[model samples]
Target: MYPERFSNLPEYAFPRLRALLDHHDPGGEVVDMTIGEPKHPFPDWVPTVIADHSEEFGRYPPNDGTPALRGAIRDWVARRFGTTLEADSQIAAVNGTREALYNVGMALFPERKAGQVPLVLIPNPFYQVYMLAALSVAAEPMFVPATRATGYLPDYASLPPEVLNRVTAAYVCSPSNPQGAVASAAYWEELFTLAERHDFRILSDECYSEIYRDTPPPGALEIAARMGADPERVVLFESLSKRSNVPGLRSGFVAAGPRSMARIRQLRAYTGAPIPLPLQRVSERLWAEEDHVIANRALYAEKFAMADDLLGAVPGYASPEGGFFLWLPVPDGESAALRLWQEAGVRVLPGAYLSQTVAGENPGKEYIRVAMVAPKDKTARGLTSLRDCLYR
Candidate 1:
């Protein structure tokens, strides 16, 4: 029997998009700008390193990750974020950040809270996993709007007392998917304070932490350390998919306060799928090196500049602070997506697909998410076609 918790769940995004636009034929050559898959070149040495470690694949991989991989992650965290963590005690590797993100809900959410159903606070127009994770635990999933009026960041501090009382966890994405909004230091401070006050865990999704135009985005663990907040209140999930252009590598890690790490590790010990041994070796190398990441960031910066040059002058065009998406404003995201596909052959996701309807309104209805992960020339052409076919 299907779980009652998922009964009201909205249709998954891609199928909904297919239903919305499948009848129409493209007016021009198709250009897909919907998904946030990275298109940059991966490091040349990665394959060789993975192949070198191929002999280890016959053995079951360690749930806590190999010491070498863990040390590399620890060193990378220290170098990148200036936060020190013991490789053995405070971090655990997962197949990818998505698995870590989803499983955290299973590991932490309580059966009941304050004599009521527990709440899992998630940003509207958030990663779909956040909501599903909450539902999987039978927690009430609260969608907080992250609209332009709120600087594209949810104002969790303003939530009603009842909601706050029941909240057991909150999922926040920095360099947020679809919006590309990076959380500032002040934002982190506020969230940290709120988590402390409300007694809820903060799961920070920072997979897009490396791709930025101007400055590096501040990480949740870094900010938590700087604030001297309760260490266990925050957990961070990071990935090599976006950072190293190795999505198929399926390498990511979760770092948390020791107590949280213990719980997550305990749960993962039985159910978690560890990244394969060879890929872990590749991830170790990828995290320790910065040259390839810097080059990839520069490529994205160029794309951001190209997008600005093409679409910046348009009304309601707000450039993203970090990451590789452009959340372009339109009259209606579904209609604009269909129009772009039918007229310009540019495939983009309707903002509505990424958001839930609340109070009879879908916050993402008037926008569309454009991924800038294609090659420079192709991305430029796609953006120009989108601009002329939709904006003009």
Candidate 2:
């Protein structure tokens, strides 16, 4: 009975990779580049802070978040975006943005919209949680193509009136995963305009906000505030995983208007695994500090520059403006991945694993997503092997 809900979902990305290539022995020393897990060092001070607050682990953490943690998030938001927010009413510290992303659909999605089955707009080649979240709420998920043709971001404004009218929410990933497309300020404004016209909400995922170059990616909340849009229009999710190199820390946050936050916190009261208090204490420190995040971004920047130096001359190679991934064009993602693994022992993810097949074609079928998350030397070796084996 339980299987029916998620029965339509495809096999997840990693397992699919295993099925495709695990049976074969490595052609050379394995150069794993498939998973997006960061290999950089986290703040050395993190453990000290956690140890100092270890006693708090005995107590149950706040359902949403501790006052200090939420306040730190608010301060970070203000400092980073120049937009002030109410920590008490508008923010909730989540285990990670992944959990918050999934639960937002549960907490905020309406049973019906415009007297019809509500639709959730998801970018194709998306973070997988967005689709699962939509399905959890029984909303029909519309996979909008975010391919090379669309500038690697979905053009939601182009959707027909029928589709727009039924949209309960839309998930947007700035510095989007796998593809590394960063949404611009004008893009956010256009999205806000569309939402205002259609009365749908925007779920903006900006976990990679800090992993950029000269210009920081414009956030939905910042743009919405500039336009003075409804406070309830955008739900923002962010994380310290990429920003602070603490994926295992499983710490992130969600911010929304009072009404939406209330719903989120209420649902969280029942289903949330509130972060352990010690971890919350550590998270408070992580969100407030900037030096470590800056250092972390510099490390990624170095790796990105390396990717450009190596792959810049290759056709269809675009140095990501933000985020640490290369969405390289290939004859077929699955086939290229297989060849790379067998011929050079370089592991990479097929872009098709991250996207849905809609209509007749999978938009990612012609591309492969390479994560530049390994150490400098290892990443250099992997990229060289990949270029030699595939591009050559």
Q: Each candidate: how many clashes?
A: 0, 0
- Which lDDT tens digits does candidate 2 get at residues 1-392? 77576887899999999999999877778999988888899999999999999998889889788999999999999999888899999999999889999999999999999899899999998999999998988888999999878889999999998889999999999998878888999999999999999999999999999999768999998998999999999999999899889898899999999999999999999899888998999899999999998888898889888999999999989888888889999999999999999999999999999999998889889999898998999999999999999888
List ranges where model 2 is wrong by over 4 Å: 3-5
lDDT by residue (258-309, candidate 1, tens digit) is: 9889999999998999888888888888989999999999999999988989
Give the poorly placed runs of model 1, Cα more than 4 Å off: none
C-alpha lDDT of all candidate models, in order: 0.91, 0.92
- Listed in order, each prediction's TM-score against the native is 0.98, 0.98
Cα displacement (angstroms), candidate 2, residue 390, comes to 0.4
